[model samples]
Target: MIATPQSCQELLAHMVGFDTVVAYHSGVAEAERKLSDYLAGLATAWGFTVRELPIEGACGNLLIEHCIDPTLPWLMFDSHMDTVGVEGMTIDPFGGEIRDGRLYGRGACDTKGTGAAMLWALREYAAGSQKPRNIAVLFSVGEEHVQTGARAFVEQHLALLDWTPAGVVAGEPTQMQVLGATGGFVRWKMTTLGQACHSSKPDRGHNAIYDMARLVTALEDDYIGKIRATHPLVGNASAAITVINGGKQVNVVPAEATITFDRRLVPGEDGQRELNAVQALAAQVAASRPGMQVTHHQFESAPPMGTVDGGQFANQAVTALEGVGISSEVAGEPFTTNGNHFAAAGIPTIVVGPGDIAQAHTPDEWVSLEELDRGIAGYAAIMKS
Candidate 1:
């Protein structure tokens, strides 16, 4: 068995040494296997039952359970194992180098920092005489891309688990603040069709690119501009045309053009409703231009997280941080997380961790050692509370 990690820094160092960068489209990788094996060994050494739920070929989510009593309410902690690609990283991506009181690596700030803190807290709790609350820790896979691991856990493992959780805390770069609300999003593509003809005789054929441009302008003015709904914490619902592609050679008139949209939703906004609205807008634009046709295809939709502010779970988290002499406030995040899945399943969820979201996917990502140390105590205190 691998030696037990004595501190958060040591655990983070060991974790960052593995290049768990998940490749797009292709999911299989050796780094995730090594890291999962190391984590499983540590959990087993600490008297926790470990189970690996396969998400794909060799990638899976690890569930570490320490159940003292089935009657007690269980609390779940979650963090992701996969990191984004390190193609343009400035420093060695897997070096785990510490400099100027910060640890630098790909997943260091995004989640490994939080994961180390969670493990350290669990270790400390298992070694102490105090009978902390029953807990389950999930190290999920594919969080950086599609969140297949989290979905699998909720759909497959949640029903199979023996205990029902009272609450869940998802690990993210929240700067140690409790996030009770977060935005959701939907991504889709729109295609505009036209007729192809000789460029010299432009009057004979319609240009798809020009039709797409008109559609974009109409969407910006009529659809996006008309949205007046807003949320207190997560701000307003918004939409953006993120990607556009079209055309062939300069001599040929393009027959088709496409654009992708990223639409952010607040708590009350329904993703399907929003998609229908966009489709209607596209139909309206197509109708305005004779002989033009537009089609929309949706790719993904994640619901916004809405937990009661200052409720039991949030208050408990705040009290835990305060017990450790760390001051924090409940806030909202503009981005979606794995917490959304749990919250959507009717479990009260909070997102809290040690780093800033700004540094999550940067070139030289880093997390403060001081914050990580505080996170260890904070998480332990939450369990104890």
Candidate 2:
């Protein structure tokens, strides 16, 4: 289990072979559970203590530890096990093909590469000359969707340890940069209700689509421009209409129309307050019309990764990357990560990992083998810190 470049690639290939997409219908996805089993088996064989946490509404998590001394604090690393769906991929999504010095697969770049690198790094650290700190690796699930895995871990499983971790590095596609901040998000759906009738007698029916059009226009014209509150690291908040559905048949006027939007939250802003503002705007739109009826359903509100109590650790992480010949600085990401959960729990959390974020969830996702090797070295150096 020495984490060489070749070994990391081989491990990533095995990881990519499992289709661990979050199954919303069945709660924790079966493939994700299987993948966790596989990693737990490997950790057990390598002399690490493994604990399985079967989450209720998400794919479960694995907490694998190597305790050199029980009295010492721990350094934990987290990387999710689930990936987004692979519907429009151009290449074999699970093939793990190698070409032009890159490894191509669904989760190769987004996160599986980081998990593999971390495992290999831990392998080396356990056998290294200086084992100053106990190490823990959290392979969390449901990161691509609701982030329930990380949330559950912070809320429930963190007490399993004798003391809180000294620092936590949540693995993500950061191009080897240390991330200090990341945006959070809130998603909601709105449905407009109206009377339905045959298209031949359209005058007798009230058009829900027409009402929905007005609401969408109001969101674009009035609401989108107002959420301009900015943070120095993560930048401005954004609102986008991502999904719309209406009409049951061509011959009938639609009775209901639904639209979903995502609102990105910056560091200082509050998710609940912003969601309330959107609801207020939609209520205004409905009030202006004679018979418009609208309903709002808030899906989820997740907080952003703001400055942690242990902010000084970012400097140590940067220095660690520098030691491995990878020039890195403290930066921010527009997208969110599992680090948000740790940061909310008052742990010194930073996001860093192997690949580029641009390749994540793309049709032809990939990770450069050379960068992955460097990632292994960088993680090893961080462990030493």
Candidate 3:
């Protein structure tokens, strides 16, 4: 059997070697399977019981448990296995090369760095004589795209567990700081339909592109501008039209046009309510313009995370960072993480890890060794607490 990783850096290198970008579009499935196998081996060697919870075909979530007593409150450390697609990357996506105290790879900074740290902390806890609490490490898949892995774990595995966790620390790039809250998101597509005709006879057909332009303007001026309330940490709720597609040809009047919108929700904001408001606006716009049909399809609505447990876990996390000599303040993230799903499951969740968010999903993604070492220490401290 392959030996367990001796250190956090070694484990991170092994994790970066896997090209576990999501399947279908990327068509690569071996990376997640291989990484799961590696983690299972290490968990088995460390005297932990490992369970592979099946997600979509061939993709699964790995849960490693080190339980000293059933009565003790369990603490869960979560991180995703999949990384964003490595298209247009400057460095080798799976190279796992270390240079100038930085590790270069796709998942190095975004998540695998924290995954390694979590695993290392678990290993250390298992080897140590004093067991502070029961621990469970979850390495989930499909975090970058749909979050199928995390959702499945919550609905399937977490419900089946005998004990509820005291808290959950989701692994994300936060420069070794604790994230107390984060903005959630709602995304959808709005489409306008009209009749197609020749450019020379443009007056004969209603232009879908023109109809969509009016709809966009209405949303920006009416719906988005009306959001006055703001979360203390994550700032005001915001909306933007991210993608738009229209004309089929230069000479033909387009018969259909579509635009995609992304709306960020602050804590205490209802994502479904916000989406319903948009749909209402779309219907109003369509009714105002004769022959112009506007329709929207809701794709996703992820709830915003809040410090619902009265900040006990946040305080413990802050103390953990301070013990490691890492200067960190409780903060909020503009983007969501797997923690959103966990928080939805009634688990007090926080996002903390190494590296910077700016480097994630970049052309030459990298994480500094200094921050990685600090992350390992911080996670160990948190687990012990």
- Cα lDDT over the full model 3: 0.87
Candidate 2 lDDT score at position 116: 90
What value does the lDDT take at residue 27 in candidate 1?
52
Q: lDDT per residue, candidate 1, 82-179, as tens digits?
A: 89888789988888898999999989998899988998888888777775579888998878765767787888778877776789999998888988
Best by TM-score: 3
Tens digits of per-residue lDDT, candidate 3, 86-182, equal 8899999889899999999999998999999898888888888868899999998888876767788788877777877789999999998899999
Question: Deviation in angstroms for 45 in model 2?
Answer: 1.3
Q: RMSD of candidate 1 to the true fold?
A: 1.8
**Against the unseen true structure, what C-alpha lDDT does each candidate score?**
0.85, 0.88, 0.87
Candidate 3: pairs in clash: none
Which run of 10 residues does model 3 get worst, by summed lDDT?
Answer: 22-31
How many backbone clashes are present in model 2?
A: 0
Rank candidates by TM-score, best first: 3, 1, 2
Across 302-330, the per-residue lDDT of candidate 2 in tens digits comes to 79998776458888899989987999998
